[model samples]
Target: MSARPGGWRRRWILLLAFLTPPCRRIVALGSRELDGAAAPWDRWRIRVHRSICTGCRRYLQQLEILREAAHGSTDRPPPTTRLSTESRDRLKRRLRCEPAKS
Candidate 1:
């Protein structure tokens, strides 16, 4: 059988399939700002996207997991959390008494 017409039809079908509402929705949501609360339109867009797109839903779940993990660690205090002041004379005396490295 001749395959030219069949291949052309298949290509059109695949292109239209990729342009569907759900795919567009997911693309919009995936492109939104990830760091903070989205605007009203963005919120709606994300809602629609998540409702239709399983992959984006899973991506949101993974994002939440990573956010939780990022916040879970860090028991140690920062180095600058404490402050100390010593007299310059005391520091100079200590330095003078110390032996020099060879």
Candidate 2:
């Protein structure tokens, strides 16, 4: 059999079609990534993503269980509430954008 001009193009098109993921899967993966120790707003975004993407619902449930376990552990303070004085000073300095005036 002789190859046509479009034969290679057709193979590439098929490959691309196979590699493309469904929109719901993409959203699910994004939600999974954002569910781990992310900010509150990021967690909210993951929740919203999960609401629309049922494929990720199980992943979200797993994340929620993990988060609960982490919270139950008393070994460390919550990330949102724990800040060293040095860190606080650095943030203040960055926000002020200038050395202390006096």
lDDT of each candidate versus the true structure:
0.64, 0.63
lDDT, candidate 1, 17-63, per-residue tens: 45444655555555454665457766666665565457777887777
Q: Write the per-residue lDDT of candidate 2 for residues 1-102, one digit (tens) a residue.
A: 888989987777556445545546545555556555455654555555555546566766776787788778777666877888999999998979866666
- Residue 26 of model 1: what lDDT? 51
Q: Pick the candidate with the highest lDDT.
A: 1
| lDDT score, candidate 2 | 0.63
Candidate 2: Cα lDDT at 93: 82
Off by over 4 Å in 1: 1-34, 75-102
Query: Which regions of candidate 2 fall more than 4 Å away from where they truly are?
Result: 1-36, 63-102
Q: After best superposition, candidate 2 residue 58: deviation in angstroms?
A: 1.5
